[model samples]
Target: MTGEVRRAETDVEREDAFAVRFEVFVEEQGVPEDLEVDGKDDEAVHFVGYAADESSDGSGSDADPRPVAAARLREVGDATGKVERVAVLEERRGDGWGRAIMEELEATAADRGLSTLTMHAQTPVEGFYRSLGYETTSDVFEEAGIPHVEMEKSLD
Candidate 1:
């Protein structure tokens, strides 16, 4: 539950994010590997979360920071951004990492003068986004063979 979430600023960190996506989307959800990594990664702003004290030896001191979650955001209109590829490792699902990730992303977007944030969320997890101040903006639809719907939040 304790970690740092920030916009990915290094190639290594971005790779970590991609690895998390592979774990959640491709391995767990059966999303085709071919469709998981889109061409937008190079230009999209990516976010990664890393734990400072996750340890296998139970010491929990100075262990290597491990990537736990990832997300992508890209500015679409003059004052809006599209968030995509949100992924959280199975172990971290109930610990608020997802919300923390979005919080960090929203903070970045707000700082950049973005007025809105948008995302296509899977049907089952739409409630999670709703809790974060997003509202459904589209009927249920499918993306990558998964049922999803567009959600949006004004950044005021």
Candidate 2:
């Protein structure tokens, strides 16, 4: 990906990350309101991606980055990091922002002492996650009114 992706260090920064996710998953994709903003948001580490050209808006700018993406990672048990709320702006799909977000999230998971990364990927994008080394672990299921599949990848 040509964009720079990094973890948002503070609560306010994480909220901006969640805003991007809400734009895509809740507003655009029709994910349920309750599902889109789960309790995990308070506990997970959030990541945000912006086009290299975008100015550092001093933490979490409300302005849209040229190419924006977001995701959250939470510790699952003792060794796994669960990734959730991954989203990229509609116009930025083909530009590799999604993959950049995934890579950044994985790196964050690794840095947090997690040995595995897991996510429930929307069915349409399961292949994309698979290409990133995530392997399906369950049959298709409905989540937030969308079909999804559980997938996991080893951090090692």
Candidate 3:
């Protein structure tokens, strides 16, 4: 539990974030690699939660921080934000890393003066988001063949 979550501020950090995303969505969830990484990454701000005691590649190298979870956010309107790519390593789930990523994204949203924050949360994880003050705003819908629902929160 000795980890810090922060925005992915470097290209290498961004890659690490994507690696976590790929591990969760593409490798474990059976999502296509091509579909897992949408082009929106270029315009989104990414966040990563790194465990100080864990190694991402299992090499145990201190030079590279192990990123356990990741998420991204982008402006959808003048006062609205969209969240995406929320993922955590299977081994890291339920350790608060996912919520850590969400908190960082929410702080970023509020910093940018966004009044509303929205996301397409996988149906199975809707309760997780709900615990963070997000409310389901739309009925279940399929995205990438997986059931999802739109959720939102007001930054005010």
What is the per-residue lDDT of model 1 for residues 60-150, given as tens digits with 9 covering 90 to 100? 6546677889998899898999989999999989888899999988988898899999999999889999999999999999998999999
Ranking by lDDT: 3, 1, 2
Give one digit per residue, the lDDT tens place, for model 3 in 1-117.
668899999998899899899989988999998898778898999998898877667776645669889999999897999999999989888888988889889999999999999
1 versus 2: better TM-score goes to: 1
The ten-residue window of minimal lDDT in model 1 covers 55-64
Clashing pairs in 3: none
**Could you tell me which residue pairs clash in candidate 1?**
none
In order, the Cα lDDT scores of the candidates are: 0.89, 0.82, 0.90
Best by TM-score: 3
Pick the winner on TM-score between candidates 1 and 3: 3
Model 2 per-residue lDDT tens digits across residues 15-70: 66877888898889987878877777778888888775454464444364543788
lDDT of 2: 0.82
Candidate 3, superposed: residue stretches over 4 Å from native:
57-63
Candidate 2 lDDT at 84 equals 88
Q: Each candidate's TM vs. the true structure?
A: 0.93, 0.87, 0.94
Q: How many collisions between residues are there in candidate 2?
A: 0
